[model samples]
Target: MTESRGQAPRSGLSYLPGEAATDPDGTLTAIGRSWTWILGSAIATLVPGVLVLVWPDETLHVLAVLIGLYLLLTGAFRFVTAFGREHGERVPGLLVAVLFVLAGVLCLRHPMQTVAALSLIVGLTWLVSGILTLYAALAAPDLPHRGVVVGVALLGIVAGIVVLAMPTASARALTRLLGLWLVLLGIGELVFAFAWRAALRRGDALPGAAGPMD
Candidate 1:
C-alpha cells in the first residue's frame, strides 16, 4: 500500500530528511531553543562573581587558576591556528604561535606569579577592549543593537577600572558578580528551551491536511 500524502513521514536517524531539507522554518524554530543555552552562560558567569564577593581569599587562588588555564588554552589555539595557516603562506603566524606557546608555558610554570603579572596584563587588555567596544558603539549607531554594545563596553570599563585600582577587592567582587550572573543566565536558558519547544509544537499543529494519494 502507498503511504498517505497527508501524513508526514518519519525518517530514522534523520528526522529531517529530503525535500524538506532546507527547513529554514524548522531551523529558526530550533534556534529559538538556544535562549536556554545563552541564559546558562550568563548564569555560569555569576558563580565566579559570587565567589569573589563572599570569599575574597579563595577568589584569588581561583582567579589564578583560571588565568593559567586560559593562557594554556589560548597558547594551544594560537599554535594550532598558526600551523593551520596556508602551507606556503608568508604570514608571521609561526612567530605568533611560538609567542603564545611561550606565554602559556611561562604561566603554567609560574602560575603563582601569573596572578600578579598576568592580572595586570589582563587588566590592561580589558581596558583596551572596553575602550574599543565603547568606540564601536559610538561610531556605529546604525547597528541593530547598539545598546548592548554600549552596555558591554561600560561593564568592561568598570571592571577594568576596579581591577586596576584595587586588584584584590576587584577580584573578589568579580567572583561574586559572576556567581549571580550565572544563576540568572541559567534560568533564562531554561525559559528559552521551553519556549522553543512550545513554539515548534504549535507550528506542527496546523489544521486541514493536504489530502492523501502518494
Candidate 2:
C-alpha cells in the first residue's frame, strides 16, 4: 500500500497513529538479494576447511601463516576503526590491537610454537565464549539472532573439544586443527551475514517508511 506522509497506512498495524505500513513483498526480495553475499563468504570459508581436513600436515604450516596474517590485519583494523570513532573509548580497541600484535610477534619468534600456543589460546577463549553464548541462548530463546548465537556456541564447543583432545599432537597438527575451527567460524559468520543482509534488504524494500524494529 502506498503511504501518505503524516498519515497511517491501511491495516492499522501500529499502535501509534501515522505509523507506516510495511511492504512485505519488496522487503523479502531485498533480503534475498543480500543473502547472496553471505553465501559467497560461506563458500570461501568452506574451501579452507576442506583443505585443512584433507591435508592436515601441510595445512598446519599454512594455518600458522594464515593466522599470523589474520591477527596482524585484524589488529590493524581494530586500531583504525577505534581511532576513527569520535565518541567511544579507545581502550577496548587498543587492548585488542595489543593482543593481536603480541600474538603475531610471538608467532614470528617461535614459529614452531605457533600452532600449540594458538590452539590453547583459541580453545580457552572459545570455551568461555561458548558457555556465555549458550547461557544467553537458553535464557532468551525469543531473542533476535538467537539461532545464530546458539550455532556459534556449538561451534565454539566443538573447536574447544578438538583442541583440548589433541594437545599432544605436533605443532603442525595443532595448527591444522586451529585452521579447521577458523574455517568453520568463517562459514558461520558468512551464514549470519547473509541472514542479516537479507533482513536489511527486506526492511529497506518495505513500503510505508519502515524503521528498524526494536
Tell me the tens digit of each residue's lDDT in model 1 across 101-130. Answer: 555465556656634465554455445545
Candidate 2, residues 90-188, lDDT tens digits: the string is 344355456655665655555555566767755754565456446544554333355774786688677778887787898766756776776786677
For candidate 1, the TM-score is 0.42
Winning candidate number (TM-score):
2
Winner by lDDT: 2
**Position 189, candidate 2: lDDT:** 58
lDDT of each: 0.38, 0.49
